[model samples]
Target: MLGRTPLDAPERQQEVFAAVLGVLAEVGYARFNMDLVAGRARASKASLYQRWPSKARLITDALKANLPELPQPDEGTFAEDVRQILLAWGEPTPFDTAGIFLGLLEGSRQDADLACLREEHVDRAYTEHLRVAVDRAKARGELPERLDADFLITALISTFVLRSEEQGVIEGIVDGLLRPLIGTFRAK
Candidate 1:
């Protein structure tokens, strides 16, 4: 008979979130369970169930809670703003981001709930921030009239995802890839 542990405390909730991420990273979504999170968090499984009611809800909330505050850079120049955003995006997390991402990808394939949660919670946030920067650049006439903001944002995000493991990749991507690409789209 598991009893409910109070999760009202902010620190307690953070501890649980950390545990959830750790378990998700280690075992992936299919093998992840409330019991594992409870053991790692030192809380009763019932407490988590009481609070979240479902695995997808719990995982989504935990990921949202752990996400870094998105940076809003107004460096005037679109290129510099993007460079700042990339630097902030590459900051380290407390958990294994790669492992958690892999787990989410695996779980999302089978679980509609998890898939929706990932798209809504994880992907949307990053996309929205990038969209803002692109919109600003367009408004300032820094980008070409026909430039595809969506394509630019997606390309920037993809570059970060693919080359993030390489050392100095953020600066390299900005200076070597992004700057050159943006140059092609500058107002003549």
Candidate 2:
């Protein structure tokens, strides 16, 4: 009974994805719906369903594609690598995504589909980013050989992702938290 929105063509995938993110940034995940994305992308709802079975799946895929990659900094030190990671994610746009991320978290609690998406996509990506940098640090003798990258990353992410109503305060807060953590790692 629903009208098809033109997303069936394979070539339109990129447009569809862009539209998804735009919609997510605009209205966020809670108010977001397939129809809106389809309309924005000028694609069919059926085409979207063909590619992603649920809204969470669609958004997760788009996020993975759109989010900036966390590269292992080649600053030749663990401290610099950590600083790069914090700085890259501390940008205003990334901070804005944090709200959508929190919405995803709350939604995941009630939606099994979203929960799986967060675990498989978000968690894995976060772990892999930190793991690469930490492994490199260990190889360079900057960190203890047995240091747990996951725990360290969790601590970093907790501070990086803290909610802040005032955007201007974010840099100072992240700096205060990261300096000690980086120093601790450097001391090892």
Per-residue lDDT of candidate 1, residues 24-117 (tens digit): 9999999999999999888888778999998999999999998778788898878888888888788887787667877888899989999999
Off by over 4 Å in 2: 1-11, 90-96, 135-148, 162-175, 181-188
lDDT of 1 at 126: 81
Worst 10 residues of 1 by lDDT: 1-10
Report clash pairs, candidate 1. Answer: none
Per-model CA lDDT versus the true structure: 0.84, 0.70
Best by lDDT: 1
Query: Per-prediction TM-score, please?
Result: 0.84, 0.69
**Model 2 / residue 137 / CA error / Å:** 5.0
Residues 8-97, candidate 2: write the lDDT tens digits: 545566677778877776776678899999888876777789879999899888777766666656777666676666666655553356
lDDT of 2 at 154: 78
